[model samples]
Target: MTDLCPRFEGAMGIISKRWVGLILFELLDGTKRFSEMESDLPISGRLLSDRLKMLEKEGIVERHIYSEFPVRIEYSLSEKGTALEPVIQEIQNWANDWVTPENAQKD
Candidate 1:
């Protein structure tokens, strides 16, 4: 008898944060700016930045800085992050099937 896998726990630690799943889902389509992610998700800028930094550090997300007049920064999924699409999609499907609009959260 031994531990199954610490990697699974590590993954849960990453995705269990409130805004992380949404942020990954948002980035699934393509690259988006910080402002875009902020607007799309209901999370605060500070929290979003923190999550992005964590994901970047984990190699799940990639941040790109473009040299331009104003300087442009964008975020997109790395190969590791892209690999989560199926898992996220299944979660989305489960939510659609199980989470009723009446019981869901909204302001």
Candidate 2:
């Protein structure tokens, strides 16, 4: 058998992290503020901040700042991140088929 491709392994290493995939899935809708994402997801503010920073560093997430009274900040997927939508969709489809509510609860 051929050895695993390093690039593919690297991609999976980032995507397979806890909350990472869900973050991507959520961002697929469009840009969102920190509080918006925090409320929409079940993750804590600190952890979500950490993950967003990591994704920003990896060029998967873009951070935007607006000049406003509250200094609004928003996050959106980069072109690279946008490319993940189809893959995420496929995973969603697979999960819908194989990962039932009961099956998911087992983990």
Candidate 3:
């Protein structure tokens, strides 16, 4: 059957991946370098790069490069991405209610 909530479906398609939420959560603090994100999320370099690119295309993330000897690049949440904070918080609250520490520990 066709999905009625196309907007939500599209958003879920982008943010429902395993690493996407962690990536966005990291950006919530501030901008971070590619290396910093890799260290924070502990994901492989290739997958992180791919997710960043997808988020950029979706207008939820921005990449900035500084001209330096080593060429530093950093990623930050776009305005659109910041708008998602409330939704993320609500999800967190919902999970807190239903997902007990005991259940979490089992997995």
| lDDT for 50 (candidate 3) | 96
Candidate 1 Cα deviation (angstroms), residue 68: 0.7
Q: For model 1, where is the 10-residue window of minimal lDDT?
A: 98-107
lDDT of 3 by residue, 27-68 (tens): 989999999989878689999999999999999999999999
For model 3, what is the alpha-carbon lDDT of residue 27? 93
Could you give candidate 2's per-residue lDDT for residues 1-107 as a string of tens digits? Answer: 99989999999999988899889999999999999999999889999999999999999999999999989999999999999999999999999989988777432
Clashing pairs in 2: none
Please give each candidate's TM-score: 0.92, 0.94, 0.88
Residue 25 in model 1: shift from native, Å?
A: 0.6
Model 3, residue 103: C-alpha shift (Å):
4.0
- lDDT sort, best first: 1, 2, 3
Error of 3 at 12 (Å): 1.3
Q: Which candidate tops TM-score? A: 2
lDDT of 2: 0.94
| Candidate 3: segments with Cα more than 4 A from true spot | 1-3, 105-107
Q: Write the per-residue lDDT of candidate 1 for residues 1-107, one digit (tens) a residue.
A: 98869999888999988889999999998999999999999999999999999999999999999999799999999999999999999999999999999988774
For the record, the alpha-carbon RMSD of candidate 1 to the native fold, in angstroms, is: 1.7
